[model samples]
Target: MKEITPNNTNTTNNSKPMQQRKRKADTLGYDLNLATSSGGETAEKGGDGPQRRLWVKDRSKDWWDKYNSADCPDDEFRKAFQMGKQTFDTICDELSASVAKENTMLRDAVPVKQRVAVCIYRLATGESLRLVSKKFGLGISTCHKLVLEVCSAIKDVLMPKYLQWPNHESMSVISDEFETLSGIPNVVGSMHTTHIPIIAPKVNVAAYFNKRLTDKKQKTCYSVTIQGVVNANGVFTDVCIGWPGSMPDDQVLEKSALSQRADGGLLKGVWIVGGCGYPLTDWVLVPYSQPHLTWTQHAFNEKIDEILKVSKDAFSRLKGRWSCLQKRTEMKLQDLPVVLGACCVLHNICELRDEPVEPDLVNEVVDDDDDEMVVPEVALRSEFASKARDTMAHNLLHHNHAGTSIL
Candidate 1:
């Protein structure tokens, strides 16, 4: 899978009569909105008599006017949308130029605040597009359009500022912090790979099939992978998203743009700690896979677990804060990456601003990264990495930095 990239959106589902484009495609697997709106102010559809002014003028303002203000005044508001009012404003300000539109003679364009709110609320709650329309007082099709638009804006506007590799100076700070936390030197980041469930596409079903997860659950399942690298503070420094779910962590890493960066010598001297699933490359250090480990090796593995927890806890908070990542979304398989990228950017903002996730919302993240044991070939297992791991392990025990009490 590749990282976030802008894609085209066709939001032509208007209030006009049924057209060919409005009809569902053969491959469409979900019922997001076969009953979607036509967007006219007085439009009505289905069943009994007329239903005028669908989901407008009542729930929308009471929900919007209060929470959309400069002073949020309620943690309830934060629950509704994942971030504070100020943080909301900051995102709006950053994405204003991209998402903002001028009022037309026929109707008003969605303001930046409302647009951003609609998008984030949909993601934070994982509600259906129909429910999102009702909550925001928008047309179902319009809600879908706004979501796609805002996600594109976040990827184009906010991602570079919020989710990017550290500069040389920042890398030094991250390395020092990681060393302090895990007693390992020259380790700037902790890496983990996790999968997000998705509705199986009619085309390429087998490519997206998660055989390992499906067998574990005893039912058919599908997903796409997300590989993330986090600093000591649990902020993302790099990411590879939207790979096929069937691919293991090592294959996913090999296919990622991150490996290209490493190949280009971006990670020549430093190490990023990963699980045993990854090969022991010169720039990547993984736990020892041998069963009969020495005391020094065992000590190294324990410290490596400490680093892995940073990535694990970050993902838990990420999925906990924005629930959309936790379940299969009705979004198109092609468009999933943009929305996932938006969630990652928002997660970074929340972590940077010290926004606390509601305790009850936290879900147990089960990453099956260690499903495969590495029997590394010579090319995969670098001599340099082996020596570096040994040196770090010996220092941890001899220098009194090892965990003292095994009892």
Candidate 2:
């Protein structure tokens, strides 16, 4: 049934009504009414809506007045701008001072510090050209050019001073060995090949890494060999890399300049201690005397072996960068060995100074066993070992002339 309610008693009118009231005369109690003057807009309190970012009132000046207070257009950033300007001026002053110290050539160009920084960052981080250019605010081409120039300068200036050849008196002990690489065996100082497996190029693949099985011998990958020499303290004195692994040690040694010195010539009277690999006559290898006897020779040989093992680990951990050397690029193959030798020298310098080796493992000595004297049939297959035995036999052919005269 439809019923009529009293005028003031209607359900819609009976509900509680919110009384409309004006904000009490600026309750925040600021000096000026900034909200109304700035064209107040509807703003959501929490939900997504337009925001009111009010400007604080100041007695001394207005917003625009305070912002552009002085004649300088950007008064807000003036202090920071001034700081940057002062830094720029200081750099200019330093450049001027440096230029004053120089003659004509260095005065009108890029500063020496920048060049040094470019080279140092390149060497230490091995960063690419674009990254270096961005960091130094230099052109990519400029960074590349500076790096090459600095490397060349270092090679020319520093190498001659620090990397001169050691005299006979300077080197007390020398250790030598041959390492196999790319099927070519080169008579090297240490056998720590750290076998870097390179993918065979498309052409002449077999020549680089032979994979075919032959009738009379075993199948082997094509690899190159590097021959190196280290001093008594474990620094590489010399290195000859890039002979094929298939090449015999004797052939590599015979052609090497070091071999010429070994033939009773340049390095006369110098005694070299070598493992069973090097075919040089002036070297002495430890004998398996009396079936794994704990003699002086055995201990010495063990020491040499330990040194090589440690050196290999150290070389493997080297963080140094290497540039691919190509013959077509007019780069010499010898430079690779030179850089390797430099690493070894640096290694030795660190070792001699009692600095910790990065590898952090000390060489361990194994217990001597009589079984070690047992020569495997593989010993006969080694050309170097066979030649050394033959040479020993030939040297033993000398007659006792003094005993004959006494008798």
Q: What are the TM-scores, per candidate, against the unseen true structure?
A: 0.84, 0.42
lDDT of 1 by residue, 115-203 (tens): 99999999999998877776676666778999999999999988999999998899899999999998999998999988899988878
Candidate 2 wrong stretches, greater than 4 Å = 1-147, 173-226, 241-254, 269-277, 284-301, 310-407
lDDT of 2 by residue, 197-284 (tens): 2334445555445232121225344444445455434455554555543444455555665666656565553433343443325432
Best-matching candidate per TM-score: 1
Give me the overall lDDT of model 2.
Answer: 0.38
lDDT of each: 0.80, 0.38
The number of clashing residue pairs in each candidate reads 2, 23
Per-residue lDDT, model 2, residue 228, is 48
RMSD after CA superposition, every candidate: 9.5, 22.6
Q: TM-score of model 2 relative to the true fold?
A: 0.42
User: If candidate 1 were superposed on the true structure by all CA atoms, what would the RMSD be?
Assistant: 9.5
